[model samples]
Each structure stands twice: as C-alpha cells, then as structure tokens.
Target: MESNDELVDGMIKAMERLKSGDPALNTLASYLYKADHRLYEYLDKLKIYTELEKPTPQQTQDAGKLLEKIVFLLFKGLEGLQSVKSFQSAGPQYDLLVSGDDIGWKVVCKTLYLEWENRDIVIEAKATKSPLEDKQFARLCSIMEHNLRGAGLGIFVTLNGASGFPKRDSTRQRAVSDCRLRQIIFHARTNKIIVVLDKEDLFQLTKNGTLIEILIRKIRDLSELSGLPTTPAEQFQEIDLPTHLKMLYHSNG
Candidate 1:
C-alpha cells in the first residue's frame, strides 16, 4: 500500500478539485466529510449517484462504475441488510452480493426482517440506456443458477428497464414477454425470485418508502406476477404503490 502521507495528500488534492470542479457535488462531499456518517442519515447520499448518472445508448466505463457504487451504497444504507461482498469482475458474475441477516431487525419492519433475514441477495447492472433484452435477463438467470447457486434473490438494475410486451416481434414487447416467460420458468424450477428496476424506479423508491421496504414490495410483486404464488402471495400484504412503481412492475401483464 502507499504511504499514509501519500493517501492523505491525495485526499486533500481530490477535495480541492471537487470544490472547484463541481459545486453541487462539492456541497455533498463536504456534508459527508463533516457529518457523523450514520447510515440512515447518509441514505441521502444517493443524490450524488443520481446526479452523476448520464445514460447513453452506448455503454461507458463510467456508467458501470457509477452503477456499482450506487448498488454498494444501497446495500449498506438500507436498514437491516448487510453487504457480504461486492464483485465487479473479481467474484462471480454478480455486481454486488449482500447477505441478509437479523441485524436489520432494529431498523427494518418485522415483515421485511423475517423475509430477507438469512437470504442472499444478488444484483446485476446494465449501464446501457436501452431496456434490458430477453437475452440479457437470461444471462443474469444463468449466472444465478450456475454461478451464484442457492442465492435467494436477484435484481436487474437497468437504465431503461426490462423488455417484455405482447404481439410484437423481437424489438420491444416481445422481448419483454420472453423475459417474463423465463422468469416464470426460473421461479418454478428454483423457487427463487428476481426482479427488474430501471433508474426511474430507483428514484421513485427514494420517495415511496425506505430502501428495503420498496425492495420487499418489488420482490413480492414480481413473485405475484409470475403466477407461481403461495409464498409471495400469502406472505405479502397490500400496500399502495407509487404510481411509477405500479406501472413499471408489470406493464403488459
């Protein structure tokens, strides 16, 4: 590792540049650097990631890095969940993997605690601006099945949401339909859950509920939509959804 003096000097220089380079980020950075660093209060830090996100049709290295950072913050900031490890390309195919435990009992609702406790959470990111295609989603499933075996849950964090529609060719809706069909198959075969969330969904979630609460809702909603119920159905209770999340959950279903 570099000398401590070098690290401190680097931090000082980076802070100076941040103050001059980006006014908004400079403000956030100062707040974080000075504050108590409590995770609950730090939840607001998502603003930085949202501000930096600039999706393009062509994927860029910055897009992937931003997403990885966002997901890492989410797993750590959300009440009750704990991040066990994160892998960009070093671990499995997962971007960030968290293991849910009872530690969330203090900060999360009891229902969420019981559901997620002891389960493994897997997240995959797509930085491109286009909706996730069937093939792309299938890759996530394949990874979960073969690589991260026994992982209880999976999420697709996409910029443009997932594709699945009816009566269309491979362009849009048809791609969505294929993804849904695969979801059903995967759930039936493995009895696990995977859901998709676009950047907009992430933004709305910041308003609807705590990070973990919204995630619970999304997981159950996906399980219900798949028609292989019993678990998500009986265990899930009705809660008013933010209009955006409601619409995005299963648009063509």
Candidate 2:
C-alpha cells in the first residue's frame, strides 16, 4: 500500500500527462476544482489526526508536521492557478451555450464540445451536492436537444457525491425511471447522460494509500483498454513519508 504523498504526486503526474495530450483532456482539464477540494480536505484531516490524544505524542507530531509541508506546497500550486477552469478552453471568449426551455436555466460550459464526429458531447462541471435534481437534469437534457441537435451526449461531472445516481433499489428504481422519463422529454433527441463522480473516485486516495500508485495502475489499465500511452503516467516519483511525519512517528523514541 502506498501513502498520501504518493497519491498527490500521482495525480500531479497524471495532470501533466493529460496536458501533454490525453484525449480525455476534454474531461481531465476541468477536474482542478474537485482536486483542490480533496487536497484541502486531506490537509485538514492530517491536522485532526495529529491533535487526537489517542495517538502517541511522536506519531501525532510527525503526521502533523509532514502534512503541514504538503499543505504548504499544495497552496503554492493553487495560488498559481488563474481560475478553477483555467485549462478548460484554448483561449478566452470561447463559449459553448447550454440552455433549456422547460428547465429555466442556462449554463455556458467550459471546454464543451457540440459535436464529435456523428455524436455531440455536452459537458458540465458543477460543485452542487445534488446533480440529480429534476431541474438540473432537465436543464442538461434540454440543452443537449436544443443546442446539440439531440444526437450528442450529456456529460455531467461533479465533485463529492453530486454526479452519481443512487444504487438501484426497488423504491429507488421508480425514481430513477421517472428521472429517465423526464430526461427523455427534455432531450427528445439524445438519450444518454454520462455522469462522473469525483468523490466516489476519492476512495482511491485512502484505499491505495498512494495516489501515484493507484493512478498509475488505473491509467495503465485504461491505456491497455483505450490504446492510450502510459509512459508519462508511469514516470512519476515514488511516494515518501515527509520528514516531519516520520519525526512524529518516532517522537516517543
């Protein structure tokens, strides 16, 4: 199992690779907002874990100090970011209109694609906790129909638990069906919405322990499946427990 530093480094490497020319750049470029939130949360968690009285003094101090350094570097990187959507489009003034008639909402998505070959892809990234709301989904479907000629795709990417539908259950199935019906009514042209959940994916941070190891493994699989290059994704540095954190672990000594 890898550690926290490995995970952050992997994500950074993946971002660099994506920038170098990952087709999914379409989706990856807009993930900075969620990434920022995750990193920030990690910093907070480390502080709390260190301050807990149950841990030995050494462990507490080591984890806290290491995490503090990580936090500092993250903020430094964040400060350099122009906006959450800075990497979305090639230049300023680029616009992809997403509007719906029945939904009474409009959004100009960053890095939106109206058509890809014979299909259209309307992409939206939102920070809301409820991406499945009727109005919101309706707006997305309507926008696809009105703007993309109904034959494209609707992609909603959200942070935390916002973008995914609930797991299937007898009672929940009814609601899901209703939502599908409403989506059809609004879309009238296209029939699919691809939702991506960042929070769901965040499990990799803890489960794999190192961000890079998990990401590298996932990217390797994806590359094999999609025929994308895995070199850059595999080139990241290994995770190291920061000096402060190691010190905390040895504090009792």
Candidate 3:
C-alpha cells in the first residue's frame, strides 16, 4: 500500500540516474559513487607515502597521521557499523567503538558473565615503509591486552601488509611473531581476535563498500584456524579481500 505522491518521489529518484540531461546527482546512488571516488583518492595518497626512498622523520610522522584519518574515515563510512573515534593524549591511538547490533560475529564478542555479547572493535594504524614487523605487532598486543579494557577485537592497519609464510620475501620473524600472538588471542580460553589490513585491502575497500565484509572474512580466517588442525606457518600469506563490486541493471535497447 503506497501513496501516489510517495511512489512518484521514488520514481523520480530512480530516474535521476537515467536522465540524459544534467543530473542533480543528489540521490543515494550518486552519494555512494562520490564516496568511492573519495576513498580511492585517499588510498592513492597513502601509497605515495610508501614510495619515498628516504623520507624525513617529519614525512613519516605526517604519513602516520594520514593513516589515522584514513582508518577512521573508512570504518566510519561503513554502512552497517556504528563507530565513535577519539585520539587521546596517550599518543596517536584512534579508538573506534563499533556497535554489534549489525556486525554480530564471534571475532567481536565479549563475555557478559553468563553469556557472550558483541564486543567493541579497536582500530590502530602503523604506516611503515614495509609491512609492520614483530616488534610493532607485539607492542600493539601488549597495549590492547593491558590498557584497552573490555575490548576483544583489534584491527591493525598497515601500509604494506602483514608478514607472510617462510617463502614470503619479507622478514620471517614478523610472520612467526604474528602467529604466536594470534595463537594467544585465538585460544578458546581467551576471547579475542586481531585482524591485520594492508594498503591493498584498503584500496579494495575504496572500490566497493566492503570494509565490513573484508573484516568478516578476515575474522573468520583467523577464528576458524583455531578449530581446525594446526597448519604450518609457511602456508599463509596476506589475503586480497575483494577488488570491485557491480550491481545488475538491465534495459531494453
């Protein structure tokens, strides 16, 4: 049951995209298109920071700040998740608390004494020349474990990507350390999950509004590892979540 006026409004909005003349571009679809372009722009800037051969300390600092904004903006822009960000006096930690009503997953779960509940997600960024190594990952773990009270999930955003298996050309130490720390958090006894995302992942997110979807896949990747039999570390490398998404729209010629 729909009113004629309301139905007409819907028709007009739909026709906005079909119009051959100058489009107002104020519809929801137009909004999303603009958002995607903006995200890609940010992603390009981040990649530029990584290209400098010998950036001054200040340049590095600026890149890190940009990463914070990118992380906040990308997660904040996600459709389903409700988020709040605060960069506190204790260094450049951008804290985002994601509501679980829509993103209900074990990766973001917290114990409510008698049962499990969706826990807040913490996002942190470390934009380095190469992917972050063991030292950085370990430090983040310690900070999250001790200071960020009640949080069980953390998303670490890096410039390059997470360390890979033995065959991985990067530092092997980082790969081992990442897995060790993950093991600690993934244990049934503990209820925490850490997801690491690189610049590529963010770029992919820019194309389609799939930040939350990529996170879910990543969460499941680490979570499911615990239930299955242990696999050698050399087998794993970074994951490419998704590149682009297109919807189906057909018309008569």
Candidate 4:
C-alpha cells in the first residue's frame, strides 16, 4: 500500500503537471481525479454516516469536520487558490476558507444557523441525510445582510434536497417563503445573493471541471430571480483548477 506521504506527493505532482499545461494533461488529471475518489472513499470508511438510527453529537461533528477537510483538499491545488481548515477571523471560526485573488469563501458545516457576522462568502454544509431548512435560509439572509459592502454570497450545500422533516408541507412552504424574502432583502440591501447546491450539483462538480461555472451560473440565476441586474463579467473569476483539466473526484457508491 502507498504511504500517505507517497499519495500526497503523487497528487501534488499531478496537480503541478496539470497546471503547467503539459500535453499529457489528461493523464495528470486522471491521477488527481482518482486521488479525489480515494479521499472520498477514505471519508466513507470513517463511518460518519448521517443516516444512522442514532448518531452521537461527537460523531456528527467529526463527520462534518471530515467533510470540510474533503472540500478543502478538492480545491487545494487549483491555480491561485489557497485553503485553510478551521479558519478563524474576528467573529467566529469557520470550517474552511477558500480564498484567492478575487474571491473568498468562509464555510460552516452541520450548523443550524449562522449569525449576522463577517462579510466573507458563506457556505453552509449539511450531511447526506439532512436537508436544507427554513432556519438555514434565514441564517443565510442574516449573513447576506451583514455583507453590506456587496462583496459576499451565501451558499447552502446539502446531500439531499429540501427537508421533509417534522412537518413536510409546512417546512417546505416556509423554506420557500424564506427564500423569496431573502431575494427581496438581498436586492434592496446588498449585491450579494443566496443559492443552494444539492447532491446533483456536487456530483457535477466532481465529475467535471465545472466548479467555477457552477458558481457563476448559480449567482446569475439568483440575480435573475431577484430582478437584479446581471452580474458583471469582471465579477466572476476562475479559481485554482482550470476547465481544461476536467476530472472526476466523487464516489460511485
């Protein structure tokens, strides 16, 4: 079996080769893609399944941390990208930070709500079994409201779609109302917007080099929905991994 060091070194080399515009970029992309797959598998083996009948709080928190780490690793080698786990700013510690030239991401995982805080792009991650909820939508609005300077965006990522928990119909309806309210508030206050990424979005990101495009498209969709003007071309910038190095990093099972 390859040691951890060996695996990391190989991934680093593959990333470098891909960045260097090597003619064999596909081969290097494959290597990095497989590396991502292996990481996902390793995470799965950690047995942090949220579908458990009864999971301890510690287990849930640990699983969330591992998920954050996996996201950090996914964008680690993209050009002009830098990522940090458990990043601490002035207010509170974030689960992950993905920052570069023109963009910044402050991520939180497994949390019920995020208070009105700093202005970095906010991401809320949920477990595969959990669904996006109205409370979470309210939290995203709070974060967007705090971003008065119009430099931040709110993203909610979940392994499933909207929740059908407790009261399925009521929960779903409340979530929709919250989303509409968020759009109005965002349009009136800041240039920021909120969007959701479900399992399909994650799958596309891993299967293809579409992270940047996915983000930009979502932002555009939000802008349209809110009746706000379209985002400028300059506002959208590509990060670490280029599109040409298309790769797959998600697990099949």
Q: What are the clash counts of all predictions, listed in order?
A: 5, 12, 0, 3
Query: What lDDT does each candidate get?
Result: 0.53, 0.37, 0.52, 0.46
Query: What is the per-residue lDDT of model 2 for residues 166-194, given as tens digits with 9 covering 90 to 100?
Result: 33121222233334345434433443433
lDDT string, candidate 3, 169-251, tens digits: 33223233454454345434455666677766666666432554455445555544432222222223333223332122222
Model 4 stretches with alpha carbons more than 4 Å out: 1-39, 42-58, 83-85, 102-120, 147-151, 161-176, 226-253
What is the TM-score of candidate 2? 0.31
Residue-level lDDT for 182 in candidate 3: 48
RMSD of each: 15.0, 17.0, 12.0, 12.5
The residue pairs in collision within model 4 are: 78-240, 78-241, 79-240
The true-structure Cα RMSD of candidate 3 reads 12.0
Give TM-scores for every candidate, taking all chains together and pairing residue i with residue i.
Answer: 0.56, 0.31, 0.59, 0.51
Model 1 residue pairs with clashes: 80-104, 163-176, 164-176, 164-177, 165-173
lDDT of 4 by residue, 64-121 (tens): 6666655655555333344334555665444444433321111111011112233344
Residue pairs that clash (backbone atoms under 3 angstroms), model 3: none
Point out the higher-scoring one by TM-score: 1 or 2: 1
Question: Per-residue lDDT for 35 in model 4?
Answer: 23
Error of 3 at 77 (Å): 1.5
